[model samples]
Target: MGQGETEKIAGELIRQAVMLLMDRNEDITLSSVLNILADFQMRAFNTGQLNACIQAIADVSAAKSGSLREESALKDKVAGKCSSCRSSDNVTTLH
Candidate 1:
């Protein structure tokens, strides 16, 4: 894929991950980011694409987690749903 296409894919993956967190009323934290990244790693993404996707996720995750409160509470919430969490399948690819 071209650079633009890779960027688009990364953006979509980030959106899907964010939507999943939002739908579950969860804040985006480091654990959330790791969970989302784990889901993506289960797919057949190329190295460059995966790197881009990870970077995109990290960027958005940092922004979202900026106002995190009560580290212990966040940890509990993250641990609760992380075991069965999966990234959304709302991906869009160039044909």
Candidate 2:
């Protein structure tokens, strides 16, 4: 199957797994969840199938930034402070 199709399937599987865990009042760690998905993939699909699904789910849930403006701003602020002294020297000015 195509990458998109694989990702779609993986995403659905992850969603189902999440719902199942939630329904059972179970708290699953990332590793455990991945193991469960891997098992499901091994039995139901081919290699890399489960990984693709998980990636798809992550892609959907993860935040998307159109630009690095926020990151840059934070960096600018941090750049003003010295790592050792925490001093804002003239050369370390933010602006």
- The lDDT leader among the candidates is 1
How far out, in Å, is residue 27 in model 1? 1.2
Cand. 1 Cα-lDDT: 0.64
lDDT of 2 by residue, 1-95 (tens): 67777777767787777677778888864544665565665665555665675574455334223225556656757777433444567545544
> How high is the CA lDDT of each candidate model?
0.64, 0.61
The positional error of residue 39 in candidate 2, measured at the CA in angstroms, is 2.4
Candidate 1: Cα lDDT at 28: 72
Every candidate's CA RMSD: 17.5, 7.2
Model 1, 1-95: lDDT tens per residue? Answer: 57777678777777777688889999976578557766885773578767767667676667556646445445644555332244323222211
